[model samples]
Target: MKVLPSIQSPRDLRLIKKEHLPTLCEELRRTIIETASKNGGHLGSSLGAVEIITALHYVFNTPEDKIVFDTGHQAYAHKLLTGRQKAFGTIRTKNGLSGFPKRCESEYDTFGVGHASTAISAALGMAIARDQKKEKSKVIAVVGDGCLTGGMAYEALQNAGLLRSDLLVILNDNQMFISKRVGALGKALTKLLTTKYVQLAEEKATNFLKRFDELGNNAAKLAKRARSILFPGTLFEEMGFRYFGPVNGNDINEMIEVLENLKDVKGPVMLHVVTKKGKGYKPAEEKPTKFHGIGIFDVDTGDTIGKSNSVTFTQAFSDALLKLAEKDKSITAITAAMPEGTGLDAFRDKFPARYFDVGIAEEHAATFAAGLAAGGSKPVVALYSTFAQRCYDQIVHDICLQNLPVVFALDRAGLVGEDGPTHHGVFDLSFLRDIPNLILAAPADENEMQHMLKTAFDANAPFVLRYPRGAGFGVKMDDAPQNLEIGKGVWLKKGKDINILAIGNRVHPALKAAQALAEKGVDCGVANMRFARPLDTGLIDEALTLSPRLVTTEDNMLAGGFGSAVAEYLTDKQADFKLLRLGIGDEFVEHGKVSQLYDQLGMSAGQMTDHILKWKTK
Candidate 1:
């Protein structure tokens, strides 16, 4: 009765009869939905991938046979089957089962993955290693059509083809990435699947096989070869992969049979398995994009719970960008498959011609935006801070080197709760600081954000606006956007005993810390140091003249970040001031609530207050 509870590992799944797998698949899907409703994670993709994962475990000898997951969004079912069932409820929590497959987390997780388009390479590497060591275990890489669109995936494919490695690449054609699948590749898949050729071939094969006796197997092979000629995966075949069916991935038995047939079919086999994004759940099936990486929801009705009431920084950026776009006809909006996440969907709808959703290719988006800017267009590339890392080369070579006036609106620029170390945008400030002709601005609240957005747009350089995730400080917003002076810091509160210079979300907390310090008879001043790159040198000089002790805090890494910039500037100036830098530390932060992480990592107001008080007494 309890198929999931009885299962402890992949072996237990292998022990189960083929007739009982449908029930197991149902249980797995429900478990994912229920767990995600409580813990909140990548729900839709995982739900869709249940049957694939189930069949893989049933067919392959995992732990010995390596199975690599690309991006790890669809591996929740894999995690559930691979001895993580008991700890599954605590996933993406402070200290729990990881949302993505991590090698350190389990033996079944052959390679740790968070980002996309790396699975084929990793699996190929493992396959090469297996061959070198003369091992017998099979190596498989599960990649989505989304991952295939990235340049890296193709590069790996080309390399794997040359090596002619005994690797199996499963192309999970779900027809959806985080956003709807884009580009020519997705279009090709759509075209190949929807054609009458596949239907006619299947009908003819089935009827002919029915007429015959146990020669159906022979007829089935003939049908497959005929279908291959009619509706083929030519792209994969050209890449040196022996291409297989566009199989019904939802049918567990069918997948098991197909995988069984291909188990020993050597030298780079490509199996295209078509699956629904949200197969079982009705609500998720209808609105799969919204359910992709969702917050906690009521399991019964599929309504999301625990949404922040106040206006978020993303909303502020969207509103500001919308207003900016209305006046500036030259302005163009671009996102790397994250129009909804980056709050650019509204803009995309409002200005369809100007907005470009460039699929999950961040590098292309960056270079493309640069091209647009070079062509006399004001291109605004709105990407998450974490994903912005992918386009570093493009940002430097194409955008910054050319000195293009492209606005990089980096939303989720600070600690993103639950998603863990892989998703946090804390390193952007450090990485972008040294890039020449780059204007880096971090706003303190919703009001300052609007002004900063305008300021970036009005500037003639590679402007970067970094803002945190979740709700804003609910400050009074101005109707008309005002462009502020570049490379300047504004005083939030003035005092004489100590100087607290903070950026972005840390500014509000630093102000509270200053207040708390004031209660202890420690007169502390707070300044919203809006820009990270420009340093606000005059403000630092002025603050030092007022107070002997200077403290710099930011919602980023300490190494080469906002505080590091301040530290380097002060060192160069030969300023004789006791300085303290507060931010994320040397280690990768674990998953938790943002506030909890702040407290743990010593970035919270209370923590800041304590650190400052200690410094003052010393």
Candidate 2:
């Protein structure tokens, strides 16, 4: 009899014997590992969080008692327990189970989360709402220690302290956050675990309380005060939270006991629980970061199944930066805790002094790079396109305002598959194009990306290079990188019937569409409009001379995007060309394979050809 398939909900889980809970936890881990191995996801974090999620569901009267998860990647167990077990295999697939917690999906998920350090703030709000409504519901926030590196977590903690509401914040310290922990906060947390005296005191206190039946009821309070006397949870204590535990979060029994004891405690409480990143799976435990967010893998060997031999845009950027930095000693790199993901780990290893991992602080990374550029060092801040949204103000005020020479290398700047709307880089063109003193360029392939990187440094202003995720077109590479002429567009093929102007990753697709159209007797031309900021007016003029109809394509949003820039230019000039824009529409794109999404959006070569033919007939 399998404990997992039988257990449909937390209500069913509550009926099971306390001793049998560990068996259920094991079953949950097996299910999570098996499902994640088949359909790629946030494996290590979800695996480590199995016991914690199981304990929370078992101890709390959920559906009423709210449990908010920071960086919802760790909520796989929660989803399974909340009657989503049947559809768990379809995670991250289009129209299937979402990778993260979604409010529309289930009643058990009190808050929808994808980003980090937001749980505490969201939980505090819920707790306040419950109090005002006179509802007897407990609100708990399960936050990873990696999320603590972000300033928003501190801001929420301070606000929660001021509110003095009945809220519980469980700090899930796995000693890792995507990569190894950085900064003084991680050091402080590690120091808390190493206090020999505190460990002994905790043991003696537990033993002493267990012996006294009447005193055992006050065990949590007494232990908290006793621990406070020694090293203490001074950080949380000062923030007006009753600090409890450096509890073993991986142990199901220990977690349940601690959570049960602290359920009714008054005011704000912080329970520090330590767990391993990849608790059960051996491969993930050894290299948690690689498994943090991964693709399909072999379960037996713990190896990725379908890795491409061609270099990705991220790799191209990394290789280009490494070559550029060898001669330019003033060149430095910065990342907001995504060194490995952005391919800056090599740069970090080679130029340790020039590399800075600013943890999960995107705003800080942008401003810090601006400061570096202001002081004579040329800094390149590499970040995921979605994460870069957090530093819009910094880009505008700190870097662009001063006209500093900071290169913003934004990776995954398009329809990023599997991660869904929360991780898509589709809005970069719309948001970044309006900023003054910033040169925005998108590459058509890996070869162009290197030249754009070289161009960015030479421009000596706030420069942005946005590229899509995954492998680029395996075009022949230049022996050495060369700076491209800023705001210049190159015509790949000329046409008489219609001309297609495309930017970034969409250029090759547009060219393919043009080729297909030419076979159908429609003379179509294609041009790679490299810069989104400075529209290539000369290219547009040349296209207009060839044909009155022009089609603009991009991997960004249709509104206020590359096509919008072309439309704005044509409108200003009173041009007589009929314009058609092709890109993502005004909707959040769901998670799916990149090919499936492009085809569905009518951006694939065949689809684009069909769309253009239909429009031309119209």
Highest lDDT: which candidate?
2
lDDT values of the candidates?
Answer: 0.88, 0.90
Candidate 2 lDDT tens digits, 270-369: 9887788888999999999999998889888899988999989999999999999999999999999999999999999999999999989999999999
lDDT of 1: 0.88
| Pairs with steric clashes in candidate 1 | none
Tens digits of per-residue lDDT, candidate 1, 1-618, equal 778888999999889988999999999998999999998899889988899999999999998999999999999999889999999999999888888998889999999888889999999999999999999999999998888778899999989988998999998888743223333454355445434565456557677886777798677657656645744576776677867667777889878877877788668988878889888999899998899999999988989998878888999899988999999999999998889999999999999999998888899999999999999999999999999999999999999999999999999998998998889999999999999999999999988899999999889899999999989998888997899999999998887999899999999999899999999998899999999978899999999999879999999999999999888888998989889999988988888988899999889999999998887787
- Model 1 segments more than 4 A misplaced: 176-229
How many pairs of residues collide in each model?
Answer: 0, 0
Measured by C-alpha RMSD in angstroms, how accurate is candidate 2? 6.0
Clashing pairs in 2: none
The 10-residue segment with the lowest total lDDT in model 1: 176-185
